[model samples]
Target: MKKTINAPKAPAAVGPYVHAVEANGLIFTSGQIGLIPETGELQNGIEAQTHQVFKNLQAVLEAAGSDLDHAVKTSVFIDDINDFAKVNEIYAEYFTGDTPARSCVEVAKLPKGALVEIEVIAVKKEA
Candidate 1:
């Protein structure tokens, strides 16, 4: 069975799902938006939102005993596909090495009208 994972530094989930779940040696994170944990507010724009998304993902991964370096795959959802280049810039900042496989798409809407949302799958590094 899978075990749910939560990050105290990340925004609390507004839905039923936990921030992530670990099964075996892999962790699957639920889509994370730009909501700030302390303020519970969405970031101002795409750039800020993208950065917040990564930070949130990082926190969850850390809680799951993993990090971006171990990420095997990721999915990015944005309200405007045109923002891909801008978001990609921010994303590249996090996954600096051999980047994980990723899929990005434009969505009509997101929770709390977030500009972006991201989800990741990563391997738990040997402790």
Candidate 2:
């Protein structure tokens, strides 16, 4: 059976979708922007936004009984390709060891005019 996840510590979804869905042994997360959970305000700059994205991802993953360490894949969307290096720096801070397979692309825009957005697929932690 599949289960939907809505992390209380993560920012509320801007639209109708939930934060993630868990099926079998995996959790598939929706793309997370830089919105602060408490205020729903997008963070400033590529650096700050990137960090907030990871934080949001972490919250959602944890809600699904997973963490970044269990991530099998990730997809990143950014407003500017030139900010790849800056985003990578913050991304590295989150997945320091045994990083997951990732694909990043430059997009023209994001929800709430965010500089970055990230999504993940991860394995749920064993009980």
Q: TM-score of every model?
A: 0.98, 0.98
Residue-level lDDT of model 2, residues 48-105, one tens digit each, is: 8888898999999999999999999999999999999999988988997799999999
Candidate 1 local lDDT, 30-89, one digit each (tens): 999999999998999999999999999989999999999999999999999999999999
TM-score of 2: 0.98
Clashing pairs in 1: none
Per-prediction RMSD in angstroms?
A: 0.7, 0.6
- In terms of lDDT, model 2 sits at 0.95
Residue-level error in angstroms, candidate 2, position 59? 0.7
Residue 33 lDDT in model 1? Answer: 96
Ten residues in sequence with the least summed lDDT for candidate 1: 88-97
